[model samples]
Target: MSENMEKTIGEVGRVDWSHFSLADFLELRWRLLHDWQAVLPGGEYFGQARIGDVCYDIQIEWLADDELAVTMSPFFPHDGDSAEPPYDELVSGMPYDTQHGASLISSRRSFLELTYESFIDLAEHSILETVARFPHLQSAASKQTGFWDRHDAILCKIREQDDEDR
Candidate 1:
């Protein structure tokens, strides 16, 4: 895990997006998705986790050359259908419930843009914030506990490496 953490941090640190090209952003996105999968077991780009009986799908989208979005919403398990719920429905009122056995009781989405010297700065801050808020989520009976724990541990290791470098 530490080796993967080092590799992820190294890749993030090596990103030179001063030019802010689309290709650069794509590469960063790929690396981030890869790192998330590698560090968080069973975690995928658009994976699902459960809390009690409800299940939520995690979605990642490249909104623009400089922005990325991560969303979590209630979703029915694979039932031979590949259609996603309407965007409006997902982002609507809280605890959005659907007849498809999925309910967005506590869904959330975050958008991050490249507005710093290194994209890692934003990514690191986001991870830290997520980590700090994990306890609250868990207390609220969120099923994303495992994913958040792994994600936080990896980021902490990366931050430690950064500190050692200084």
Candidate 2:
């Protein structure tokens, strides 16, 4: 019934798998590490969406035996400097413009009982919303759709590796 749910159904042929489902859960975990190419890299995953001078830092918090929470923060570079924010500054939950020296806009959304496919769709939808407001993000928007697409490697890795310890 939610917007995310609508986006996830059969999008790229993936069902909105539950986090509580063991079989689907492990597959989701491995698929994340494989698609993002961050295999077995601790608990949290960090990624970014760059739209010209602004970069949206995306962090996925993997909760044990449960759901995943994704947080995104937008950061602006000063005078063409493209450096990422200090590690501590990531996920500040504040969107700021370094050139202006002040936080400007903020937006947040929450989805209860999150699903792997819904998260993907929600993330893409969030990014697309941001892109609509920020003209600079339009150019990079084309490259971001791939992130939501179904990845065959998810099943492949689950088949090849043992997740008993995980």
Candidate 3:
């Protein structure tokens, strides 16, 4: 049933989107925002890859307790998310608008707890949902050995670029 699934399942497996909830979406979104500011400059782990006549933007973040969020955004010159503060503000201990840093930590959810297996399941399930929604990603990546290779290469390039900048 799934030719576009990441794994070789002999057309046996399919995407499971039965467990979707707006609550989970909002919670994970906040987690991602917090991770963006806490771990990455400019609130994103950004990368670019050319995929079959189109270049796509890739974003992946590892949240607290091994939660993972991977997003694939196709780039159009006019479209951008300006919600995040500039690279300096996100990395620095400076707040973009607020007087204190406490307001910046809106993504905290101390009461929510999930098992290790649940965390892994959420990540894998999210990825499958994305691929099912955008079959182009699977089609473009079908020939690649690993879906993460492009992301890793872009990270290497970022390191080189950082070195050069310094």
RMSD in Å for all candidates: 17.9, 12.6, 13.4
lDDT of 2 by residue, 39-86 (tens): 333434244444343455555444333444444555442222446443
Tell me the tens digit of each residue's lDDT in model 3 across 1-166: 2445445222213322233344544455555556434544323433333323223343454445444444434321111244644322222232222112111011223213543346435544544444345444344333333323444466568778899999
| Regions more than 4 Å wrong, model 2 | 1-44, 48-55, 60-69, 74-112, 139-166
Where's the lowest-lDDT run of ten residues in candidate 1? 101-110
Q: How many residue pairs clash in each candidate?
A: 0, 0, 1
After TM-score superposition, the amount by which residue 157's alpha carbon in candidate 3 deviates from its true location, in angstroms, is 5.4
Q: Judge candidate 2 at residue 146 and give its lDDT.
A: 32
Model number with the top lDDT = 2
lDDT computed for candidate 3: 0.38
Q: Which pairs clash inside model 3?
A: 1-11
Report residue 163 deviation for candidate 3 (angstroms).
3.0
Ranking of all predicted structures according to lDDT, beginning with the best and ending with the worst: 2, 3, 1
Reference-based TM-score of each model: 0.23, 0.32, 0.34
Judged by lDDT relative to the true structure, which candidate is superior, 2 or 3? Answer: 2
